[model samples]
Target chain A: MEVYHLYSGGKDSSLAAYILRKIGYEVKLVTINFGVLDSWKYAKETAEILGFPHEVVFLDREILEKAADMCIKDGHPTNAIQFIHEKALEEVAKLEGVERISDGTRRDDRVPLLDQRKTRSLEDRFNVQYIRPLLGLGYKTIRELTERLFIVEVKESEKLEKSDYEVELRHLLRERGIDPLTIFPKKHLQSRVIGWKKEKAHL
Target chain B: MEVYHLYSGGKDSSLAAYILRKIGYEVKLVTINFGVLDSWKYAKETAEILGFPHEVVFLDREILEKAADMCIKDGHPTNAIQFIHEKALEEVAKLEGVERISDGTRRDDRVPLLDQRKTRSLEDRFNVQYIRPLLGLGYKTIRELTERLFIVEVKESEKLEKSDYEVELRHLLRERGIDPLTIFPKKHLQSRVIGWKKEKAHL
Candidate 1:
């Protein structure tokens, strides 16, 4: 009945939230925060601009330090990554009576850990349906869509290996073992704004 | 002012076509078949049943054959997939005054070459808009949305990957993918029945 979107304050998550609303789903944005990060601020701002309620969950500091380690290019979704998402959704799903827990993970991601490993398993085990709206889309296309719609700020990536298709900077960097990238205030252009970037920080 | 659907006789495409029409677009269904493939017959049948003008184009082979390498996967679209899709749109783009090419490519593709690549490129290059009403939807959700409304029978996929997401189906497949996966056929299901088989080799 009700849907809760997994909001990360990055482009992918924000787009998922936006697209969910477009498709006529009653969506509530939930953010999983480690408590000590600027990413949470962006997530909060996104929820405000998009007109969705934001839920923040604090993760264990010890577990978070392992993010860089667990986020290895080849070994994503380490038990730690899956544990955090499932944990967050497990809590979110119970409160809102949400049947679906959605995310912004795109198709270009080769994070073996998330796609084929724990993320998939958690989806079935959590009894919470997971939806990735950007799964069939690439980075460039989303850039166009977001710009055309005039959505809030730039998409952040987490350092990633380069591929022909552009993934969100956050996801891209994350795969390469780093925190997500963030760009604020950004740019001004009419036609050429299809591909815009302000400043990317590896947080 | 007018938009048409790149219909593939599948559920998502059909639903997309119907939605665009409801939204007041002068919607039409276009299906492209490779040389002698019987994809045409089903497209015709589907168009007839659904009450739309179906246009069939035989490319013998379209682009993306070498780029994305079509034979690599069944339901999944690979890199350069968008290149081929735009090539299809290019042919369709040539239609007198058609300005927008809508497709059934949804939001949940494992690889998003089409929507992210082809769709965006065409919007800029051809200066025509590309619409995917199902851009943010996963297969299960699309199925639910289709059922909630009185939408008619459409194709899911041709025979290959058989993930049941595509709109084209091979005659050898007997059962409908929906009945087992979802609830239907109660009495209203009669109208949805489409037993399409090849009366000849060349469609």
Candidate 2:
């Protein structure tokens, strides 16, 4: 079976894709482009580094604007990001031949996490299975696994360029003269996979 | 890193150990023996067939008796089984050098499932990480994966010889002149891993 995994150029999603492949699924890395910025290209490049087939799926720019507006009105990005995340999943789940969809949501993730009800609804409506490979793993284990499994670059969220809703949302916020730093929390770290370690140590 | 997985010779736990090994953890299969029966031997044989090292961890027989009483009082095995599952996790979490522990819990499991708060509490109290690789997967995906991944034997729960707590619990109930059939629901199916599929087709 083939599973389409929502890809960001980040450690969590990359690790998720890795696990799915190990579990006998042919994994396709998908980067959603909402047209606010070309962040999907970053994800595509990272996917190339990881050696998985990759593609960009374009969503309406209107959703990005709406999510940004919600952020401005609510003074936070939690609900808005979650909104876009669900929209992204729905879009991918509807594709022909896409019977299994996945994301990198983790046990410790607060924002952009799909509740069980919504997950079941998505699966039932689309006749698909939504797999979150990292859902059972918390932050500490994820850190250890990624550190051992890949070479990564970590920096503040805004400075690090990865394919996630935040990049486009931040761009839209900047376009509206709203500083994203004020909306997003301070000192938030983001990571991008650079390459795998040379040792093949796990073998 | 080494992770001790709570194994029962069932497909779910076997698949969990497979995924953990793929993620670079040396997996040790631990079968809980509650002294009601020698069911751990079944799990040991399954682990050998899968080529993983296995061990039997003895838990207090008193706990099993208490859980059996809970079942008789509640007229159902749900609460009692959950009680024993948590105790088993606690006992395994205290073993030497066990920094990570895992189980075969799935997203749809109701009874004997650990909630987020309790999972966090276990991690904090024991200073260990709890990993449930199958927790993100539902019934359909698990069935698909297991069917393709292993050679399995299926039978009614009462007739199956897996190493789950139900076997010993049922034995104890019958010893007291109670028909375990009255306590456990009817037509419940159980599975045991007999061996791997030939051809190593996935490779």
Which of the numbered candidates is closest to the native, going by highest lDDT?
2
- lDDT per residue, candidate 2, A92-126, as tens digits? 99999999999999999997788889989999999
lDDT of 2 by residue, B33-151 (tens): 88779999999999988888999999999998998999999999999999999999999999988999999988988977898899999999999999999888978999898888899
Residue-level lDDT of model 1, residues B1-203, one tens digit each, is: 36766765556676676656543357777877554346466666766766778777655342423432332333333344454555667777777787777777765554433634545666677766666666645566776666654344433323222111122212211132322112211222212323222231111
Q: Cα deviation in Å at residue A113, candidate 2?
A: 1.1
lDDT of 2: 0.90
Model 1 segments beyond 4 Å from truth?
A: A37-39, A68-96, A110-113, A116-120, A151-203, B1-5, B16-28, B33-54, B59-139, B153-203
Question: RMSDs, each prediction?
Answer: 11.9, 1.4
Candidate 2: count the clashes: 0
**lDDT string, candidate 1, A101-196, tens digits:** 777766555431144345446556666666666665555556665554543432222231111011222343455555442211123111111121
Name the weakest run of 10 consecutive residues (lDDT summed) in model 2 chain A. Answer: A194-203
